[model samples]
Target: MRTEEIVAKALEKIGNDRYLLSNLVFSRVKQLCAGAKPLVDMDLKHNKLSDIAMKEIAEGKISIDRIDEKNL
Candidate 1:
């Protein structure tokens, strides 16, 4: 799907809160950059880490609660 569509879906997954979405995406991207395994199946070599993070959120593979738990 298109980037816009993926972003919209990811926003929906997080109750349409852009702030929360941004935070989640940022955290996930950081983890990805730090060598953390992606939660979703995708081409890591070709796709950007931020895009992969959003895809994980859009597909319900990542969520605010999960992030919170990890942080805690």
Candidate 2:
């Protein structure tokens, strides 16, 4: 899927809350940068960390409750 489509799906998963989406993506990206494995399966070599993070959110692999539980 395209980046915009992924972002829209991610936003929908989060009730269209832009701020929360940003926070979630930022936190996930930070974790990715620190060696955290991606929750979604994708080509890590080709995709940017931020894109993977958003895809995780889009696929419902990552959510606000998970973030709070994991303190991510």
Candidate 3:
């Protein structure tokens, strides 16, 4: 799916709050950069970590816990 479509679906799963979504994506990207595996399988050579993270969130392969954010 296209990045925009993936992001739209992610918003549906996460909520319409763009700021929270951005933070989630940023956090997931950091984890990806830190050597965490991609939750959604995709060609890493072509997709950016941020895109993969969004896709994972959209597909329900990843989830965010608001309560846990306090410690991060």
Candidate 4:
């Protein structure tokens, strides 16, 4: 599935259990986008991820933030 779609699906399951799982997924979204040809164009853009917070997504590192970025 596309990055956005994956993130959206994730948000669906993360109704009130916002924790490590969300961080991990958000990080994945950033990481995957970083590997994309045009990095800027591959962002997931869910919740409200900031540039710094976005690093987790790019590097696949664990983060404490609870927001995701979105271009929708």
Candidate 3 lDDT, 1-72, residue by residue in tens: 777898899999887778878888888888878777786778778888988889888997777883155244
Q: What is the lDDT of residue 12 in candidate 2?
A: 99
Model 2 misplacement above 4 A: none
lDDT of 2 by residue, 1-72 (tens): 999999999999999999999999998888788888988887779999999999999999999888777676
Q: What are the lDDT figures for the candidates, one per model? A: 0.91, 0.91, 0.80, 0.43
lDDT of 2 at 50: 90
**Model 1 lDDT on a 0 to 1 scale:** 0.91
What are the per-residue Cα lDDT tens digits for candidate 4 across 6-72? 4444444544344744565556456455642223333445433433234333433333343343321
Q: What TM-score does each of the candidates earn?
A: 0.90, 0.89, 0.84, 0.27
Per-residue C-alpha lDDT of model 1 across residues 1-72, encoded as one tens digit per residue: 999999999999999999999999998888888888988888889899999999999999999888887672
TM-score of 2: 0.89
Q: Supply the TM-score for candidate 3.
A: 0.84
Error of 3 at 46 (Å): 2.2
lDDT (0-100) at residue 11 of candidate 4? 42
Which candidate, 2 or 4, would have the higher TM-score against the true structure? 2
Where is the poorest 10-residue window by lDDT in model 3? 63-72
Off by over 4 Å in 3: 66-71
